[model samples]
Target chain A: MIKLKANGRERVWFYAFLSPWIIGFLAFTIVPMLTSVYYSFYKIHVFNMNVVEPTFVGFKNFKYIFEDRLFLKSIGNTFTYAIIRVPVGIIVSLLVAVLLNRKMPGTKLFRTLIYLPAMIPIVGSTIVWRQLFSNDFSLLNFLIGNIGLGPVKWSSYDNAMGSVLLMSIWCGIGPSMIILLAALQNVPVSQMEAAELDGANAVQKFFHIVVPMLSPTLFYLLITGIIGALQAYAEMSLLQMPGDSTTTMTMVVVQNMYRMDGYGIGYSSAMSWFIFFVVGLITVVFFRVTNKFVYYEG
Target chain B: MLKTENKQKRALPLVRTKKTRKLIGDIVCFAVALILSCILIIPFLWMLICSVQPESSLIFMNPPVWPDPIRLVNYKEVFFEIEMPLLFKNTMIIVVSNMVIGIAASISVAYAFARNRTREKNIFFSVLLATMMLPWVVTLVPQYIIYNKINWLGTMLPLIAPSIGGSAFFIFMFRQFLMAIPKDLDEAALIDGCGRLGILIRILLPQCMPIIATMIIFSFNGSWSDYVGPSIYLTDPDQYTLSIGLSKYLVANSVTPWHRVMAGCVLFSLPMIVVIFTCQKAFTRGIVASGLKV
Candidate 1:
């Protein structure tokens, strides 16, 4: 870090340049964070415009959340969704990236086609997915029928979460593939050549060289992916899968706060804070455990 | 040269077989790529096909691969009956306002972080990056409360006002782009009596057009398609953005025409498709740049 002795004018200009972010940080992030924490310990009731009050509840919300079956079920659903989605998403993306990184014909066109899904808005794409997975008239069921398989009820209570995972993986694979592809391109060609000269097979070379080299990017993706999956709401909302066995934790938060007439604001705040803690803890554990495996090529 | 030639002669068959192996690998890769591309493209193609097909044809067990006669009535209905023009106008207002405010705020702060070399600045930058990992859920309820208290609920202010504060990701992108620029240019401008703001506006901004364009495109895409923010804040039908409007249209009337819904989806996604195609290089470069930084 280079230390520069700035004059009074430059110092003033420096703060001026940073004022917007500072103001935003305070007004948006820090205040909201603190307020959420504070509100979690109280019963916040808002009646119309002028009547609003927050009474101290002191751990009742958290206690209620722990005992709440819906909260527990949502947490379970969210975990199930994340556990299925994240690993499958990573593997699929890595496979696609590897395929695209190869010197193949029409690689650019193929890359663009695969990535185009990520560019579409989630709301619109979810609607398209609902149509595609509709049991009665679905294109998927039609193809499956041609192959002599039974029509799958994709949006049923048993399969709703699975359908959500499938759509998410499809929509999400593009960005992850782009990241992994970029990482794969950065693997030094000379190292691969050296590995080849040592009588290593293609699989051996990929596992020993490419996977390790790509681990840092994979690690980054894993953390972000887990966080994203845990906090997923838009897809669930757009897909209209709410308050069932498939209600995710984030959906529960939204449902309790917004859809439930704002009566459970404190309880919802507690739920949100609980998710924050879990996500934060998972992220920390990931960095601690995976740091050794991530290769930082200098 | 003679010894090398002799070695090469011995290695010729090995190289030939290696070439064959590589050829097989490329073929396999191409096959896989083709399958994956088809999987990705089929949904959008289905949307397009369904949007033009009449409602009677959509109820079959096996959907048609192509629209017969290709009626444009769905789009016409979406425009006239669905009030899509109002949604578009509402969306554009929020998108354009957020883009302008967000870019200005992000660039200035990013410029500050890029040019300054102080311990406190580094700490602030790291805090900003840390905030990126803080899920939006953590702030959702509290922010809603704040907005409700201020009576900005059911208004665009709640959706648009928060953006005036720089977004962490955009700020990071701008900072990274600016850091790649050399400091000597700033020094030269300073010696020529250029002020700090002038150096940013006159020198850095021109060179950083690609990143600025990237920011604009991303902000536009994000604000245009944003559902959660508007859904939470805006309650009035008249104030609904395209995303909310389309979603409500779909959810409110399940028995409504699927063709019209598909038409609305296409219209909602059309601008982004055009932006992606037209600014393909910048778009990919921006994504790749962010990915590489990770």
Candidate 2:
């Protein structure tokens, strides 16, 4: 035991302070995580599990997930959404943050308003979006209609995923923008002035200086954004109707475990593990690929 | 000639005055931000407009921003659809319990990290942080099984009690804030016969009010906005938090009442807006701190 020479009881106080978290982590997080792994390899029926013993069916649940058309479609939808949503979120939020960073008169109030979407509950914002996107009375279509385009069927199979993406971007970017704006403050003002002195235009200064300086923040947003994107649940889950094509991976796991006639505990556990692995993989890949671009102010 | 040459060198190669250029910049920035912000705020304005519009206007066509004789009958319907007082009570229970346990334990865990130097603690802290990245879906079913096994499925305990373990994100934030405070402050308190808990409470906590306030707001809003947790555990309508209640209100029937749903949404978002307006500074500070690596 690599024990420090603390007065013998100091360690006692330390552990005592840690006990609540320790207890919680064990029972709630760590135990469940371990048990989920165990459950994934076993054919554990949902309601009759206490009555019926679970059989050890190694890799069977994994086999089911890969073969299940719904699972395949849902995972595909989630990644497709992430690929588009993550970049759009980053770019749009960065643009807004730059606009706010312009520090014009009353920009602060506008910043608050811009962030208001994030402050509102997702369900609330989504319900409002549902109304706005309702084909019968779509405000979006009305606005587009003025531009000589016809009404968009926002909830159609073709547009359902896009509708959710539109709402997600609106809500998601506010926080990212705030974070990026904070990072913007740290992007050396002296460098910007020098760039200006070098006769660099706005676009040149942004790409050359601001983007590089903000890469760390951008990278952080990317990883978290992808993580969040995979779990795009509430909006998609709420607005989901018959023939709605936006069932995300999180929704798949949720329904598989919770809904009636679900694949039961074993299958959902495998799916959860699959999600865990993917999240871990994406995070690892990001760290590996984007590390060189991230400038740490040493 | 030399002075003019120096002035020309410092000045921009432009015909316009600096003041005019700055004014132009300000207008351009504001115009762009204003247009985009207004675009973003449309949903909110739509939310507000729809909440007050009569059901007649909402059903047939897009509700106008100002309905002819604005009505608040939908807010009244939210009253009958769900017990607002009881709903708030149920939510407050989750919020208060989680905050009390989550904050205190987070502080204790953070205190240990900040003050207690141990080789194991560093690894422990890293493990703790790794948990934050562990998505809730991984634990959802097993935790649900555990809760069900213990017959806690229909109660708020599932939502509230897990937080007894200090949340990894908050603990990490608190630990960072604590580490920045000089070691000598707590050491001086120790010399003055203060106990560990006393030193933590009297010396450390007051200095961390901004972070603490931030946690309060975050935890409060988190509970308020939590749809998944409430939907999963609290199966009974009587026990439903505002999120579940509002969702049910929206989707309870085939013909969704747009006005009442918006009203419920407005009600759902009210406390959050108030919390933000009150603690906006603290939240921003916490977020800025959060983005930095510890």
Candidate 3:
């Protein structure tokens, strides 16, 4: 990556030009990131004078996180949510992209329609989703009941996460599909024709040619999607059934941010680290597993 | 086989089957795509419908597909129930601040990386891209504490101040776009005694309308729809953006006045819809471009 050809004047100009990003990055990204890591290991008490006196207790906060039922439960719920939602969302998006990639009528309109919901603010849509998913008052159950099915309790404990999962998938399908559609456009038409001439059907052609060709885009979506899913906050916060039923890993940390008591600072920081590590681990594993099969173009 | 082949030549039969298969495949795909798109878009449709429904008919035990009486008064009622102008004024403050400052900073940094040739620049560029993947949760707490420490809480500073540094995504985007521009212009600008900033401003920027529009749309929608930052920092109701206001509006009320809140919700996302559709090409390009970096 070295390109050390610029003269001293260019060096000065480079520094001059990048001052805003450098300062902002150091202030916003670097300092807080390190401070949070520091906070995670210590019991930080904020006193009246804006003085933070932290008492170091190495791994105690993390220990407490492992033992805390709420934390464990929240982590479990997050894993379960993402484990289901990520793959389903990806496959659904890929299928939609593949289908839409075919020459069909009104394909243009369908693309826009699918993508419109993704543009709506999650906070606003969650409000609408909450009201719409209420068991008796829901449009979903009402539509189902009209189709000769029993009204599913969308807000019940067993189904609350399911409803959010459904919504998450719904909101997610657009962007991923859009990405996959673009990637599909890049798939070699000659390769597709070769497979077709060899007597490959649509399903076989999709599984063999298209999936591998689109794997890099799919992997990108997977990592980002999982990262996003793990950071699920606003929707889980606002849309959960009226209780602590749907605390995600984010809420595990965020709940403490609201508490007036002081112990929460360290705990919240520790939980965030836990989320951070989980995200890193998942990214590594995904990259390793996908590296064997995914295609990357120059 | 012989009888069927007799109806048409063997070659003709093969072509018919192939054509029929493709026709069936297209039909099936059309149906599935239509259905999936409908399912995906139904909630926003419901929200739009609810915005016009009367208070009692917003969500129905037996929804009749359309609201009865279509009380467009709900739109006006939104203002009386909540401080619409104050919320909009507040939200637009963050959006415009982030848009103007964020775009400028990102473009400058991008230009620095694009034009500069240094090992450090290369390393910093990679770091910037990596930061794009770093989930905000890792920094959420310390940043909050920092904001609290700096007394930036209860104001829009926490929401607004971060953008002055530039965003990684936009910087990467601007850098990618800037790198694609031929260097002959920069060389000519240099020969003509244009300053570094002068070159970027005069020679490069006007050609970057698409990425700028993309950033503007993203920044506007991002800050406008943002609830988390404002929820964390802005404690005062007087400073609430519409998104935070919408989230709190439900809890702060008895039944949530769904019709009116739906009106608020519609207004909340109306600007986003307009911005996205108007700049549909850039919007999709941003998404596709950002996603393909892997």
Better of 1 and 2 by DockQ: 2
lDDT score at residue B240, model 2, on the 0-100 scale: 84
- lDDT digits (tens) for residues B1-294 of candidate 3: 869754554457687867876887788888888888787787888778878887644454355447777889988878767878888889888898888899899999999987887558977875674565444655666687788778887988888888988987668556655654547767877999989999888777765665576576667767777877888888888888888887787778766676777788888877776764565343232332332334
Q: In order, what DockQ does each candidate have?
A: 0.30, 0.32, 0.32
Tens digits of per-residue lDDT, candidate 3, A170-256, equal: 777876675566556546566687898998987899889888767756766676677677667655655656564543334433544
Query: What local lDDT does model 2 show for residue A63?
Result: 89
Residue B8 lDDT in candidate 1? 67
lDDT of 3 at B50: 74
Which residue pairs collide in model 1, if any? none
- Fraction of native Cα contacts kept in each candidate? 0.41, 0.41, 0.45
Of 1 and 3, the candidate ahead on TM-score is 1
**How far does residue A25 in candidate 2 sit from its true spot (Å)?**
1.4
Q: By TM-score, who's the top model here?
A: 2
Tens digits of lDDT, candidate 2, A164-201: 78878988766667556655654555668889899898
CA lDDT of each prediction against the hidden true structure: 0.72, 0.72, 0.72
Q: Point out the higher-scoring one by TM-score: 2 or 3.
A: 2
Clashing pairs in 2: none
